[model samples]
Target chain A: EAGVAQSPRYKIIEKRQSVAFWCNPISGHATLYWYQQILGQGPKLLIQFQNNGVVDDSQLPKDRFSAERLKGVDSTLKIQPAKLEDSAVYLCASTLRSGRVYNEQFFGPGTRLTVL
Target chain B: AQSVTQLDSQVPVFEEAPVELRCNYSSSVSVYLFWYVQYPNQGLQLLLKYLSGSTLVESINGFEAEFNKSQTSFHLRKPSVHISDTAEYFCAVSTANAGGTSYGKLTFGQGTILTVHP
Candidate 1:
């Protein structure tokens, strides 16, 4: 099966600018996740969706970051007025179930964002 | 609340040498453990996971991790690694249960970069 897909493999922007990243998870997968990975660090979960409903968004910066999974499928993440610290890779992943024991997550190639 | 810690930020080793990457996790509830590998310019791929039963799990590519409940550690190890094994590895934890409560949201550790040279 094809893996999770993402667009805009790389992006460069200035601080205070806005940028968006898109993700298309594996067909039929019900759970989707967005993560931010800074240089030399592990990916941090930003948001999670089960179908079209948000399951978690505690780590998301409500001031400048937003994400949506429409129709329970494809999703997008936006960082508005980006900060210098916003420079990182945005990753998307999908899983067959929201349960921890059911299935493993499949990930996309990720969008690398650089802010000046 | 949950958190994961990887003590080593970078580990360099020669081919055919043994290596270990240490990981510790803190969680109030029962949690599932996982190891993920990220290749250059790519996203993370699941290396292995520990849910229940055995405290040991092995990945296809000659990697194994032992889950030590007492130590609260899940350390990845390889007896002899190849150059292709070079990559960044992450350890993550999430509640064992699913649905509205846990959402299976993963909390990841600071990654460990393993560089294998010839």
Candidate 2:
């Protein structure tokens, strides 16, 4: 079975520029997630979508970041006026359900964003 | 709120040697613990997890972890690691919020880089 898929494995942008990353989850997966992993740190959940509806986004920076999963199969995360602090790898993952090991998630090759 | 801490930032060992990666966690409610491994330029993969059963959990690759409730720790250990075992390891905690949506939000620790040399 194919794993989660992401686009533009690497990206580079200026501090004030805008950037967007894309993710296509595993087939038949019902849950999708976006995470940000800064260098020297673990990945932090940025948002979660359960079949096109947001399940959680409390940690997301609304002022600068936005994400959407219109069809519930693929997702896109965007950051406007990117800051140096936003330089990190953005990972996407998928699971059949929420909050259970039986629904273990499979992650994608993250898109590394470098904001200069 | 749930948080995880990995005590070691980096551990270097020769192949066929024993190694342990220590993890500590704090949470307001009951939680599930997990260990994840990531190879270079790759995504995170689950190694093992502790939910409600036995305190000891073992992965298919001969790696094991014991969940210690009193110490609030879940440490990963391998008696004899191979060179292929070199990777970054993460400890994570997840909890179901009492009032909010029932999704399990995972909090991960600063990863530990384990390097096994031949």
Candidate 3:
């Protein structure tokens, strides 16, 4: 089975510029997530989508970041007016369901964003 | 709120040597714990998890972690490390009562970089 797929394995943008990353989750997966991993830190959940509907986005920076899963299959995360602090890898992951049961999540290689 | 902390930011060990990576968590309620490994330029992969039963959990890769409720710690250990074991490891936690909607949403600690030198 194919794993989660993400585009532009690496990206470079200047501060104040906008950047966008794309993700296509595993087939038949019902839950999708976006996470930001800064250097030396574990991934921080930015947002979660349950079949196109947002489940959680409390940690997302609404002022600068936005994400959407149009068909609940592929997803896109955008950052406008990027700052140096936003330089980090953006990972996308998926799971089979949106239930309480323990399920393994498959992750993409992630899009490494470097804001200069 | 739940939070996890990995005490060691980096650990260097010779191949075939025993190693331990310590983790601690703070939560007012019961939580499910997990360990994830990430090789270079790769995404995080589940190593093992601790839910309700069995304080000790082992991964297929020969890595094991013991959930110590009394000490509020879950430390990953391996009897003999391999060069392949070199990677970044993360400890995570999720509230048991988070329910279906928020069930798998995890709070992760700063990662520990394990370097196994051959």
Question: Residue B33, candidate 3: how far off, in angstroms?
Answer: 1.3
The candidate with the higher DockQ, 2 or 3, is 3
Task: Enumerate residue pairs that collide in model 2.
Answer: none
- Give lDDT: candidate 2, residue A72: 79
User: Which order, best to worst by DockQ?
Assistant: 3, 1, 2
Per-residue C-alpha lDDT of model 1 across residues B1-118, encoded as one tens digit per residue: 7889999999999999999999999845577889999887667899999877899999999999998988899999999999999999999887754332444778899899999999
DockQ of all candidates, in order? 0.58, 0.56, 0.66
Give the per-residue lDDT digits (tens) of candidate 3, residues B1-23.
Answer: 68898999999999999999999
Off by over 4 Å in 2: A98-102, B97-102
> lDDT per residue, candidate 1, A1-116, as tens digits?
99999999999999999999999999999999999989877889999998999988999999999999889999999999899999999999999863435477888999999999
Runs in model 1 deviating more than 4 A are: A98-102, B97-102
> Candidate 2 has what TM-score?
0.94
lDDT, each prediction: 0.89, 0.89, 0.89
Query: What's the distance in Å from true for residue B56, model 1?
Result: 0.8
Top candidate on DockQ is 3
Which CAPRI level is candidate 2?
medium
